[model samples]
Target: MTKMTFRKLLAATALTGITATAVVAEEVDYGKFDGYTLRVKLIGGAQYEPLYARIAEWEAMTGATVDVLSRKNHFELDREIKQDIAAGTLDWCVGSNHTSFAPQYGSIYIDLNGVIADATLAEFQSLALENSTVDGRLVQLPRHSDISNLYYIKSLFEDADNQAKFEAEYGYALTPPETWDQVKDQAMFFADAPTFYGTQFVGKDEAITGRFYELLIANGGALFDDDWNPTFNSAAGVEAVNFFKDLYEAQAVPAGSLNYLWDDTGLGFASGTVALNLDWAGWASFFNDPENSKIAGDIGLVRAPKGSAGIRTGWSGSHSFSITETCDNQAAAASFVTFLTSHESQMVEATAGLLPTRAAVWDDAKAQFTADGNNFLVEVFETYAVSMSEDAFTPPLITPWIEVSNEIWPQLQAAILGEKTPQEALDEAADAARIVMEDAGYL
Candidate 1:
């Protein structure tokens, strides 16, 4: 089936959780917002656009109108929101948010704990809700969780010639990698550059910084010491940075990888030229549908590989919604966000492979995939579910996280591009991070 068809079919499947266990089907109410125009700024992308399709339903039910002031990718949307904050023009009622980015917004967003009903909050996964809280404020309502696992072309590992060749050279049978070291070895081995490469990463911005952070944590490193002093320049940090540097040096990843982000990495893997991709569940169907992926039906997956410390790399967060503190219509804004993250709405998103923030949707999504005979998606959820629960963690949830990340990524890029040694790059980044932490009163 085509990728588009798969999505449409999934949405129509009527899997469980039309009303989650904690949600009152008819007892609780979505307050009337008649004639109230709830202005919002949203994060836009193919995977996220479908949920917006239900906006009319909410409008009809509440007799209100939604004014989407802007729709841009998360990075651009974040920049725009910051601009609004600086200009003191937070006229919009709702905006898109992320766990990694919410802290920086501070008091600009109101605490949702009081605005949203406690019963509604109870419907979400406790861990996700906990992560959404920053400095004791429930600033955002999680739309969907984000966590990654490894995806590879299964056919390559199944080839008799390839398996024998790999076994002869590495003294082990060729299979999906179970550790970061094996990933490097296999990626380097499979790379036939200009035609095919072994793996790729989102190499710039907080994208790279977050990647480095998770790998650092997997190697038993922390970004800060007990007193909140910068400590990522430790030996573990050097090791983490070297992994990317070595890949770039060996041409195991794309030549233009340093410029890539999530979209670039997702599309690169779908093009069938990359062997292993660490990606979120949102792309599971896209990567397996012949209409969108050249390697469709040839995909394999596993939990993200472990670092030297035996911990898996599971950097995670959520795409979410928030209400502005300056809003004149907080009640309307609250209702709108609640409806957007409702069980039925989340079910629509989950059908398209986005992980749910509500705990019940996990089992429902898996059961639906099983009923549809989609073993790949079933495995994707199973693997990601475990990784998210056991290995997933966020970057430091502090006001200066983005500022600190900005200082670190450039140095990380320089190291990966061979302009600086890994130790030198991390040392510089650590110095810059220390300044940011100190400025934020963390040091």
Candidate 2:
């Protein structure tokens, strides 16, 4: 990608990342903008809403009102942003961005190197800032990082009958799964259809494409070779696709799973009808609350299972805030994002189980959880921390990522729904993706 002169690769601060130490929160000068109404677009979902509650404090301190124009999921927001870019209608000051999706926007967003104070940027974890950088430009501020870990029903594995039955059928003990094959076997064992399911996944949009990508990596397949030729129709790719297809065909997952997104799978597991769910840490508090979940006290968490190549499935990224180049209130916009990702702001999100981007919050939040006797959240943090460090990785950080994903996911669904064999569907998707890479000058 560096060989080309793409405007999208506006390198942010390409400096070596500095690790923050245990230091006092430096007071920032959030400049007053009285009578100023900052227009913004934000990512909205149950897991992401807690931090928005702090906007009132920023409004009071800065004397500016926040006018949130749109609050939707990432996929919908991506579509809307693309539309805005086409019509030259980026009338807002700030918008939500992700590591995987930020590259698609080109130079629409301002590089934040000098916009945010070096002190403020240094407070964040090195990895989060590194992922937020595009080619060379630091285009966004990291909000919270994300990686999936398996959440399952505790009692199911403890049930004596289940153990005996599973051992008799599969020649293994009934326990937390350690491999993808074990997960398939256990899911099939527990599923009763329409009432109970073995597992569930986000089935459409870039969500499924991401799920497939991680599994493809786990099965020892790369999306492209050194020259960026599409190679996902290889043997390992077929095996990964078959993992989802076989579950769907056997009714081990929800019948409507092909249309389900994150909310569906998260809520399904909490309802106690699903035996397992692979999900992010933000749902930890919600999943364990008796007021919101039927299986509140019966939950067990584990790292995601490994695949045929003995590699764990880990597709990772960060949710972030970005400033628009056209914003009339650039200073105010920078202040807003700084306030949003500040130590205090991140603590609010961390309390709700969202991984903090600011390094200090990790220790402080765990200490708070221990003081509060919230062992579940402590465990949740520990389990997720390892995955974030060891198993985590991002997809190709290229401008054509979402475009390629659009071509791949529909083909993924076709195979999952029996419209085509895995090999046939992947072949068609690979052909389409090759054209995308070629047009983008990666071929």
Candidate 3:
């Protein structure tokens, strides 16, 4: 029989990591549009801003100017879009969109089927293009895939004394975990509270909702039945919720973890204080950079762990660009959208460890990594490739996904904070979500 070590687990079912290397790709022809200004709303952060910097390149090539109306995180941008929908103010030409959030926007964004060339659309991964489509309309052009995997301080698992002690206490070798239960055990074992943590999670908003939803699926639980009755209060659901509750109660994570978003958990891991982090590929470049990460050279990567049902937690989405349906200059908007997702543009993002949506970019990026003697990036690309093909799945493509999430998160906080049992909180959240579904005519 083959020995199943932690290092072996990181590949196959074990999982992925990354770093940056610039590759200049040939530019595509985005028609000239002199004397035109394009307006956009973008998702802004360190990992994402590098791609937006290339907007200047797009402008120079096309002779058009870009006016970025707002540059904020997705959660904030989501609220702005929601308000725009409520107030009838979706006047911008193009905006950032996500597969998980696109259904809620109705038809404010134009269909890209005829807008973008079929030849160009053919270059993107079919699964990516499929996720960007809502109600049979290709509402957005995918930028990159968003899938999380495990990242940890490598030296921690490699320490002989620590490994021996952990093996004695847990009756297993101290290695990268193959399952979520192992994750909990290792986390608590490594934790030394207030000074450091075993692990940390994104604590609130649709962020936490996605985390819970994925864990629920991992535990063989469904959020709703075939008829759409909310079923997140089942035994499997309770088990999933307890995963977070136990971590919080044991102080395995930071005291402020319930309020952490991506930045907090990401920076925590980079600071070398946290033992484990499950995060997106976009941050891989930053995490492995010595200038930015204290544990840069000592990092280990693995696929996200499996739950009791043997399913890995794979809550996935894509960051994308979309043109508004009401734009006065549809041709210009289309040109701009096409330019941003072109081969060269994806190459720029690929350097930042952002997973490319363009199928060719993946091959080219991995080739560049191998040529550069960057085995870390090569391993990351290989591990993440398996995840993208087999494990990745989006939340239910429905108009009320965010609305339902609003009801679920607060109750989840209640459960984690010890105010309610997992069942009680999920049941109440389900009651609220049922009303939302009925109001939306899903029931």
Top model number, TM-score: 1
The better candidate by lDDT, 1 or 2, is 2
Error of 3 at 207 (Å): 1.4
Per-residue alpha-carbon lDDT of candidate 1 for residues 275-309, written as tens digits (9 for 90 to 100) = 99998888899999999899999999999999999
Tens-digit lDDT track for model 2 on 6-37? Answer: 21221111121212445556478899999999
Please report the TM-score between candidate 3 and the true structure: 0.91
Count clashing residue pairs per candidate. 0, 5, 5
Q: Which candidate would rank higher by TM-score, 1 or 3?
A: 1
Worst lDDT 10-window in candidate 3: 13-22
Clashes of 1: 0
The regions of model 3 sitting more than 4 angstroms off are 1-28
lDDT score for residue 355 of model 1: 91
lDDT measured at residue 12 in model 1 versus the true structure, 0 to 100: 33
Better of 2 and 3 by lDDT: 2
> Clash pairs of candidate 3?
9-14, 10-14, 10-15, 14-303, 15-303
Candidate 3, residues 1-443, lDDT tens digits: the string is 11123224323221111211222235456889898998889999877888888888889988999999999988799899989889989888999999988999999999999889876776777667777889899999999998999998899999999899999999999999989999999999999998989998999998999999999989998898888899999998899899999998999999998899988999899999999899988778788889988988888899999989998988889999999987878888999888888788888888778899877778778988999888888878877877776677788888999999999999999999999989999999999999999999999
RMSD (Cα, Å) of candidate 3? 5.6
Cα RMSD (angstroms) for every candidate in the order listed = 6.4, 4.5, 5.6
Best by lDDT: 2
